[model samples]
Target: MEAVAKALHPDSKEKRYCNNEIISISKQLLVQVLELPFDSKSRKMTDLLKTFDGLDITKYANLVSQKLKINQDIYYYDNEHKNYYRGLQVMYQQENENDKQESIKTIRDADFEVIPQIDILVVESIWEDNKISHAFAIANKQTLTGLKFCPHCNSKAFDPKDKNYSRDYEIHIIQCENNEGKIVKKVKLDYIQKPFVPHIMQNKTYQYLLSNGRQHEFKPTQYFITYDLETVPKIVNKKFGKSSYQMYELFPLSVASTIRNKQGIKKIFFSQQDGEDFIVQWLNQLFKEAEQVNADNQYITEACTIDDTIPYSMEVPIVGFNSSRFDISLIISQMQ
Candidate 1:
């Protein structure tokens, strides 16, 4: 009877999987996720699908629905142009807004307060471009209606007394969902502008100034450590020379590690010879430092070339010169 089937299988529409099979699959997924070292906080539903590389997500969803006692849909958020995950989005029909067909504008226009809770999972290998790198797991909503103002106007100029003689002034404000679900007010953008800030990475370079016989420390994270090192060739271009010609041989390679310690200081690791070995050693230390904050493994080894091998095991987060462009690119290209 329909009642008998429903009682036996909570999520079974077709009565295919018995309760025992559903329970077993649920346990399997939990165990697999527990074994993975990848950060659970960073792993999105898309990443979960990728974890089961060969499995069809829709089929997997069906299995999960029966096993977990919930209906689910998957969605991916594209984060390159904005923040949050990219590709297929997941919606839980019963509790989430996806139960009813909704337009993109409805989702975008709804007051930030009504926006349903979402879990954006960062995805790897969205496209074929190697140079494109995600800075971090930045989770935030994108909005257009917060505030815009004329750059030439100052806040003091706006006075209630001058009703007729009004100044054409506007101010730019951060208009997005905040913890309190309110848009920020008009404020001077310059006040928040920090110099020597690493443009996209939210990092900054600071220093300690020994001025007038007094030591003053600027922004704690804005500092540098200086060290000198000799350089060697990591790559070479070979050509047959008809005649002997003078050419520049070895270039000096300096090693520096930026630490967000009491102050953002650049810790330069000076070496007499800047060769592959020295670079690798320095990277070992850098990687160790990054591990404290959980950076992605693929990005950390971005610079290693084909000649250089990915260690059988990742001991620490590696910081290498040109690792982003060279090492990561080479490895990804080779894999393809």
Candidate 2:
């Protein structure tokens, strides 16, 4: 995950977050801190530390306060020293825990940057031309090849099925040079919706240049994407007889490889890791990759199609074992 982060933003210097350690600490803290319930006699600042070992709850005051966004000034008062801690520092005390509502209130108050859920497939289609039709492989085929100049008059005919052309389909009867001019081939086309840009044949027949002793080539365009998954541990009786960590797995690999081999995928990238923070970092990288793929496609091709052109240029597939059960489930559940 850090490797891709570094690759995307060459200047990024911060060490990657340790997902496993954070999750473990967060879980332990939730139980210890929240269990006191503000009214418990055991609710003490020192007691809270005894439970949440790794977290500096005081620094999180800002995180919590910003989340709450209330007007109250939260500061730490050193009762024994007769002074208040500078800079919004609040020490956890037995009395402080008395207001479990404040902790809950703090969580509710802090200003957090919430990442909006993005529909990657929809997003990719929106940015590129005729992107939606291209993404629906079953509906449209040969996207790049579909737009070709009329062999006879050099006229550009829009694809018959493309919604851009509202006019009725027509059969264009043209003379076939292959058969003497007498033989005609019935060509059906959508003539109403013509692309703003001129369409050229991508898979042109190649010939050997006798003068240079070199072969001409028509390279197909391609794209790539990388993914990662983080899973929470769970014990289930479905697969294992005894209790064990049921790792969540996602099938992005199967989907990606299928799209690649079956759908003319040129390249694929798979970056696998464990834990939630890495997953967040991975998603950020994934979005950047998708954006880059769209940019590169538009740069070279006039009208790129998900069906005709490669889906990912630097296709990175992040596969995690048992991800389908855990990580995918979490994402789906969270979305809902």
Candidate 3:
């Protein structure tokens, strides 16, 4: 979890509110200082911290205010303390902007202060006359051959009779290419997505990225997200289990993964209940948006359908022992 958070927000320095250590500190700090819970089991230990019910900071709100009064210079106290809440809000806004800038590797406009494209033809006309290289030339596939993701797919519904199926489908696509138009298999990928979690941002969901003024955009064929799920297994007796366990359905409860591109943009997503679909779909949208280039050859910065020219793909490798036989089978069973 720590690793996932770090990857997602690389510039983030502060510990998350739901981190195990942070939870431990919050509980200990409040319990020892304010004598909270008064019972042993109340200590927040041996727990995988989650966001909603993880930190119970309510009991110490007044205590923190009291302590703030002791250090007027350090804290916004008395008259200054009245505006402390508002000040914190401004700081959060600024921090979010900084994070956005850092994540996207923002560049300055002055860096591209070269001649415009209109004048490029004037230079190109004289380039051959002077026997020099020109900037307007294009690179041929024969000269620039590398990993080309194959767009062919074996995606079919697991239960062919079930028309209600969506991602209860399997993806067994192989990455093959014609190196300079000669057929060759570069890499083989066998992946599937089944029992897909309910979409996170289904209705009126808070879009964290959009809220922070960050538009999710990326170049196609440049990024890939590798992930898998931890599902609620139907036990022999269908007995209820712990933490990530589900009582009603075998849903994807928890997911964790790293999304990276060749441009040094790396992000991690880790969540429970309904995060898998959001992240997966977000990546698809990223490539789709990147492919929506205008007449000027610039990405239109809009949501779009999956562009076949763009390599929008995901891979799920077995995570644990017998996952290939158990977890993997359960997910791809519909396709079979």
**Which model scores highest in lDDT?**
1
How close is every model to the real structure, measured as TM-score? Answer: 0.18, 0.19, 0.18
Instruction: Mark the regions of model 3 whose C-alpha exceeds 4 Å error after superposition.
Output: 1-224, 236-251, 268-272, 275-323, 329-336
* Superior by TM-score: candidate 1 or candidate 2: 2
Reference-based lDDT, residue 239, model 3: 41
Error of 3 at 38 (Å): 99
**Error in Å for residue 23 of model 3:** 93
Instruction: Please list the Cα RMSD from the true structure of every candidate, rounded to 1 decimal place.
Output: 27.1, 33.7, 34.1
For each of the candidates, give the backbone clash count. Answer: 40, 31, 3
Global CA lDDT computed for model 1: 0.37
As for candidate 3, its clashing pairs are 76-81, 158-334, 158-335
- Model 2 TM: 0.19
* Weakest 10 consecutive residues of candidate 1 by summed lDDT: 145-154
lDDT of 1 by residue, 199-307 (tens): 3123211221222222232222222222233345443444557964444344445555654433344464734365545555665665565554232222223354321
Q: Name the better of 2 and 3 by lDDT.
A: 2
Query: Candidate 3 local accuracy as lDDT?
Result: 0.33
Tens digits of per-residue lDDT for model 2 on 213-239?
423333344444433343334433345
